[model samples]
Target: MLTVSEKFTAFRIHKDDNNKISSGFEQLSLEQLTAGEVVIKVAYSDINYKDALAATGKGRILRTYPLVGGIDLSGVVIRSEDPRFQSGDKVLVCGAQLSELYDGGYSEFARVKADSVVNLPQGISLRDAMALGTAGYTAALAIQRMEDNGQVPERGPIVVTGATGGVGSFAINMLSNIGYEVIAFTGKTEQAPYLQALGASKLLNRHDIEIGTKPLENAQWGGAIDNVGGETLAWLTRTTHVWGNIASIGLAGGIKLESTVMPFILRGVSLLGINSVEMPLSVRAQGWKRLASDLKPSKLALIAPTTIKFADLPQAFDAYVEGRVTGRTVVEIDASLD
Candidate 1:
């Protein structure tokens, strides 16, 4: 059987007295890991907004200090106490309190709970899984649930808020690939053509509808896959067509929801909450299966990360936080052992 070796470089975050996050490379040992049933020789990890928050200590994403700060990781399993996984099994762990209660995938190695592991389906590379990452998973989950709830191509157009971000971009592509007319919403008007290339039928400026704190407003979109919280969510909830379901996933804008019950009570609209983290293993596997099947975007390979070596993690994390980064940013670890 294979094993995790000694002294793997990890992107470590240390919180100071002021709660400022300071992240850099540090050598870690298996003994430093929190308890789990399996150990992964991390092959790839992509930067997400949440990871940016933890890396920069901007949003209180991590519950613990001095932890590795990555929420999504894909790699080969080296050791396992669980029957479901074995050595050489390619797996992925998203959410599950990594970068919070435990060290995460921004490392050459990681130990994760067996329950959090999802065996990669055929045609999905371990590295591509990181490109899809947590953001892509959540986006796929939203689209899946929406379709499961009777959303279809005839439903005018689907709205995707935060279109330039990871989740929104992937959502647009997935929806488009599956033949849904998608209307992307973003603050970045300059990215309109780029989004269109990913199958956005149209684009909506954020300042136009998502700015106000109105309780409710005009109904516009037939369906929605919303990642931006706060007014954006509220706006989408109000604007969604009757019986339309909007999946609320991320809280990038803000978590506060000050909306009237009119959309739900009057229009029969539904706000489905999406929690990719702590989701049941069966559900996660199902989501992955969906990703492998219908929800896999045609342009997925284009959004693949710009791979950087482990030593560049610190600067990469910083760039990720500063919003200068686009698409996925993958950290490449030593793959020889795998």
Candidate 2:
């Protein structure tokens, strides 16, 4: 077994009196971390919206203060007490209380429960897995749930809101790859070309999607993968086809939904809530397996995730909070591993 580091660099968040929050890299010992069965030498971790929120204190992402802040990690096991995983085995972890109830993936090394981990699927690189991260996995889960509700490419265009973010981008690529015409909605009109390149057949300015007084309208979309909830999701609910599925993922816009039951009661629209954070391991594994196969985008390089070193995360977190970054951003935690 590899000797655990006496001290490791981790980006930590601190909340002080008067509710001000500050974050920076700090040295932490192994004993400071929460207990788990597997110890991983983290090769990479990615910045999700929630991570950004936690790091910047913009949202209620953490239940505790002075915590390491990253929700997604990909790495190789350096030490394992569990038989299911051994030293040198590659794995990935997302959600499952990381960055919330537990110290998370921003550190050079992370000790996590083996049950909360998934063996890295064969044929996917550590970098590539981090590229997908939690965003891509959530996108896959959203699509799978929609498909389970009898959604099909033959139905018509699937509308994706918040189309410039990671989940929306991945949803577009995956839906298009599966032969569904994708209609992407975004406020950043400058990203039209980028969205089109990712297989969005049509692009709607965010302003174009307004929640009208009509309880239901002429259905314009067969289904929807929504990242920006609230008004955008409300609009999608009013516009989706009969028996259509609306996979609700993120709440980038706002949390409250102000809509009537007309869409569900009248048109039989199904609003599928996607909670990637607490999903069972079986579903999480299925999502990752599909992410490696049919849902894996050929244009990941085009997505061009902005990669940064672990130390640069404080600035990266600010960028994410300001909505200045696009696609995904993965942090290279251990240069020697890759």
Candidate 3:
């Protein structure tokens, strides 16, 4: 146990009889935190859908209870015994069992295993990393796989479903920055200019790409970054161009996949599963480095979240789950006004 005798607070979820959900902020001793090689003064933690799920108990995102509920965090190392990190160094962590197998980052401080923490590379601030958060990391993983599989910007417009959401918005901006003519797909017609501002050359309504009764539809998209699963995935698989790829990042729409193998066999379309959590630390570092360099958004300053005090997180988190959040939402825990 690495006890530094520091006092802090965190929002924790604890279940009562009948498994009813209740969560609120609680004061914690340094020793109450889970054991880890490094202890950080948490600087930034953004609200993600998974975090909302864990907080609300709407989904089984957290396999454990009585847990702190943040899946990604960026901050400065305050105490460390690991050779790879030392006091005052900045870093960020995403996925890596936070709010799952261990206590997490919705606190004024955190203790994280050194094995899963990635030292933030040059060119990205700790704040920027948390603003990107798990959603952006998942987006980066999907785009990296697409490029690896020979999908190119010149092939055609890359379609990104769920364009108004975090992963979709980040991927759209990143793809457009790399010169891909991006097609943004969304249910909200009001977000057209917003998506276009992120470099989407076109907008497609969700209903336009609804799961058709047919199996194989016209091959339109050269490649895709799909965050919505179920029928949206099926449509993307069947309708993507020959030899193109679709990176499946979420089951937000659903888990059921009802597509045939014709897209895989005839057109040679490929589906790559991207699990940001449980990724090797080396690979996670590489993804973060790439995000810092190429995929980092040019307009992150404009497109990034509006900051809120730690006290406001519960209502904001509830708003997120109720489908009210548009862009990012960062909690200012132990943050300086500067």
Instruction: Compose the digit string of candidate 3's lDDT tens values, residues 224-252.
Output: 89888998899898899988889898787
Pairs of colliding residues, candidate 2: none
Error of 3 at 118 (Å): 0.8
**lDDT over C-alpha atoms for residue 105 of model 3:** 88
Tens digits of per-residue lDDT for model 1, 1-338: 66677887788889888867688788889888777999998888877777877877777877878888788888888889999998899899987789889889988889888999999988788877888988888898887788788888886689998888888889999988888889998889988778898899899887775445555577778889888888778888878888899999877789898889988998888899988886889989999998888888788766764887777766666677778766777767755533
TM-score of 1: 0.93
Overall lDDT per candidate, in order of appearance:
0.83, 0.88, 0.85
Q: What is the lDDT of candidate 2?
A: 0.88
Which ten-residue region of model 3 has the weakest summed lDDT? 1-10
Pick the lDDT winner.
2
